[model samples]
Target: MFARASEDGFIHDMVLYYGKTTLEAHDVPLKPEQEGLGATSQIVSVLASTMSFPTTTAIFADSFFTSLELVRYLQDHNCRYTGTARDNRIGKPQLGTIKEMEKKAVPRGTCYYVTSDDGILAVRWKDNKTVILLSTDMGEGPMSTVLKYCSESKKREPVGCPAVTRSYKANLGGIDKSHQVLPMKSNRRYLRLFAYVIDVSLTNAWVVYKRDCKALGVKCQPLKDFKL
Candidate 1:
């Protein structure tokens, strides 16, 4: 599912598939979670249809949608991912704990990357809090740094961050924007589903329309006007 940050509240390119089947009731080596991970990879494959060679695409997702397995899957497909991950996820790096880092006098905005046996890079950074990110598409060097306010220091300072972190922070807003603009708050489940389909369609169309207008150097039509 694709969502714009805080604007449309619409989920785009959503594909639904049932998990339970007569075959599933019999013999399957993979666990249900593995099946779900495979399904998620397929969704990403569908979303990457427009991508071409040498033009890398990055997927940003929350912890629920990210794992080392998922990172490898995208890497195999020539894509990259940046997402929050739980510490316990399999193959996740044993980065130093927040306490350990604090004890070591690690400064805010400091970032470290650990490469797994499979060559996937896991990034750990200290901000207001410790953040762990899994990535396949980021380089070792920091692309740029940003000034982030540190409460302890009571001042803002330039913090070095990896490219994946920067891109994730920038692009993370699409889903949030979608949620704000077209909130899918319906009591009835069926109505909710119906609203989701409509809202996604409308939001996707609007995004394309706005992009085309920008490319052509024309003013974008208002949402009301575009809907008409």
Candidate 2:
């Protein structure tokens, strides 16, 4: 299943992947470009269509869901997006290759970036390893520092980090947080799918309940207590 969640762990939408044949049978909406980019990009487009507030929503996806075409599409739709990109998916930009960026002579925080004609910024930054990030909403400037443990130094040292990278790391854990509360074991072995669905439903309900409680200034029950 493909899911979109808020920064606080509220699942806003989900799409079950059953292959292109099933998607076509269901008449899932996909633009010409989205179709050409393949299934993962199509999923991102479908999820973007379901956004309650597209103009105000900022999407953060991992390399699995990010591509230059996807970033451009989201920008055209007026939704901001920031995500790490696979080197192959970032299009042909005049940036240093991963090997060059990872050389021992290069500084730890070295960054190379390029802007497309349509305003997509592709950045390659070196930390412990090279990370390629794409964004329609951020740039290389306004850099920040993050603490990383260095093996040679045997202590944590501050490394410069791009705003885009920092933001992605901070906000990409919403779905992970939601997954933490899901049941790991179930009694219905033969109906595991059904059990999994129920677990997700209950988790979403608890999130909504907590949201409402906070809005009304009331105490909210813990997930375990709420389930009981």
Q: All candidates: CA RMSD in angstroms?
A: 5.3, 2.2
Give lDDT tens digits, candidate 1, residues 1-228: 332132223344343444543123322234444455645444444444334441455667777667777777667667767787766653646667657655547877677778887678787777777777887766556557889887777998788787878767776666666555564788997897788777767777677777789999999868866433
Poorly placed runs, candidate 2 (over 4 Å): 25-28, 186-190
User: What is the TM-score of each predicted model, taking all chains together?
Assistant: 0.74, 0.91
Name the TM-score of candidate 2: 0.91
Candidate 2 per-residue lDDT over residues 19-82, each given as its tens digit: 6553453335666766776578778888888888999989999999999888888898999999
Q: TM-score: which candidate is best?
A: 2
Superposition error at 97 for model 1 (Å):
3.1
Which lDDT values do the candidates have, in the order given? 0.64, 0.84
